[model samples]
Target chain A: SAVISQKPSRDICQRGTSLTIQCQVDSQVTMMFWYRQQPGQSLTLIATANQGSEATYESGFVIDKFPISRPNLTFSTLTVSNMSPEDSSIYLCSGSGRTEAFFGQGTRLTVV
Target chain B: AQSVAQPEDQVNVAEGNPLTVKCTYSVSGNPYLFWYVQYPNRGLQFLLKYITGDNLVKGSYGFEAEFNKSQTSFHLKKPSALVSDSALYFCAVRYPGSARQLTFGSGTQLTVLP
Candidate 1:
């Protein structure tokens, strides 16, 4: 299992502001992904963080709203742009190894 | 597209009683089933997974899941429940040839009573 570290474990941001969450893995991984868990809801996939290319966003999400950067195999970041009250949720980063997947502690964002 | 289904939204059990959380899946190919536990305000912790070669697989925290191909189900189970086991549980699935992104079901909230 890979050890993932995410920064800004909890943050309060004003509406219309943007906050960037960083994820660092202790070892290199092939696939990295971003997910969102809304209040009292299950997780939704935000995007796939490609190592050297643009991140692939899922339906109902776009790069303009959730831009991602995967500089290398061991690091990635997800930035929630132009936040809103509805954007308040827990953001998690996950990495998949050869056999299994692992997750970070997650960042809790509250938009006010 | 692959999908996962957790039939129950919440399950209540008393301590020392066997507990079960139901899950079913749909996939075009061989399925990789996984169970994860999430505590309040925390990320998911991998409990167990069924890759292949075993009908039943055991994992962390004494959790085990049985994979039934005929039923297309992988249900998480524990012999005895504990108050500490109160948490949200999620069932996830992935196809072997797909993008490797896991499709998670709507989680089930498990509450264990004293």
Candidate 2:
């Protein structure tokens, strides 16, 4: 399993502010993804971060709202734009190898 | 679309007793199943995975899961429950062809009482 590091383990943002969370994996992985999870709730897929191309968003997610970027195999970023109190949740990033996907510590976001 | 289900929202067991968290999945192809545990305010930690071969797969923190193809289920188990084992457990599946993105279950909250 690769070691994943997420910057700014947590943050508190104003309702109209935008915040970007960064995910870095110690080793190169074939797949990278972003997810949103409310505390004590199941995870919701945000998007598939593709290297050198635009991300593939899930049905409820969009580039204009939750933008994702994967510049390379080991690094990706997810930015929450036009945030609102409803956007408050824990943001996670994961990378996959041959069998399993390993996750980062997660970025806890609180919107006020 | 691939999907996973954890029928029980919560499961409670006495300490030192065996424990099981049920999970069932639906997929178009041979299933690649995984179990993960998340402690409060923490990231998900991989427990075990079943890709092929053996039906019973063992993983971290004294946890194991049995992959029953006939039932389309992968249930996490521990021989003896510990208070520390209590957490949110998620069952996930992935298709190798679909960029291997995971489809996670609703999650089961396990509480091991001492």
Candidate 3:
């Protein structure tokens, strides 16, 4: 299992501001992913951050809104751009391993 | 596309009683199933997973899950619940050879009372 560390554990941002959440892993990994958990809802995949390449966004999500960057194998960042009150949610980062996956502590964003 | 379903929203049980959290999934090919637990303000912790071989997979904290392919279900169970076991539980699935993304269930909130 890999140890993932995420920054800005919790933050309060203005409606029009943008926040970038960072994820760092203890070990190098092949795949990294981003997910969002809305209030009282299940997790929804935001995108798959490919190392040295553009992240692949899931349906109902777009790159313009959720820009992701994976410069290396052990680190990635997800930026919530032009946030709104609806953007308030828990953002999580995950890394895939040989058998299972591991998750970071998660960033709780509150848009006001 | 792969998806997971956890029917119950919340489950209440006594500390000494057995606890079960139901999960079902749908996948095009063989599925990789997993169970994760989350304490408040914490990351999701991997409990157990069923890749192949065994029908019963045991994991951390004396938790086990039975995979019934015929019924398309993988239910998490523990012989005796503990007060500390009260948390949010999630069931997730992915196609072994597909994308690295996981489809998670709605999550089940377990409350173990002493």
TM-score of chain B of each: 0.98, 0.98, 0.98
lDDT of 2 by residue, B62-111 (tens): 99999998898999999999999999999999976677789999999999
TM-score of model 1 vs. true structure: 0.98
Ranked by lDDT, the better of candidates 1 and 2 is 1
How well does model 2 score by local distance difference test? 0.91
List residue ranges in candidate 2 displaced over 4 A.
none
**What lDDT would each prediction earn against the true structure?**
0.93, 0.91, 0.94
Q: Ten residues in a row with the worst lDDT in model 3 chain A?
A: A23-32
DockQ of every model listed?
0.78, 0.84, 0.88
- Candidate 1 C-alpha lDDT tens digits along B11-95: 9999999999999999977899999999988899999999999799999988899999999999999999999999999999989
Candidate 2 lDDT by residue in tens digits, A1-112: 7788998799999999999999998775778899999766799889999999999998989999998889888899999999999999999999888789999989999999
Candidate 3, B12-34: lDDT as tens digits: 99999999999999987789999
lDDT of 2 at B65: 96
What TM-score quantifies how close candidate 3 is to the native fold?
0.98
Clashing pairs in 2: none
Tell me the docking grade of candidate 1.
Answer: medium
TM-score of each: 0.98, 0.97, 0.98
Q: Is candidate 2 or candidate 3 better by lDDT?
A: 3
- Name every residue pair that clashes in candidate 3: none
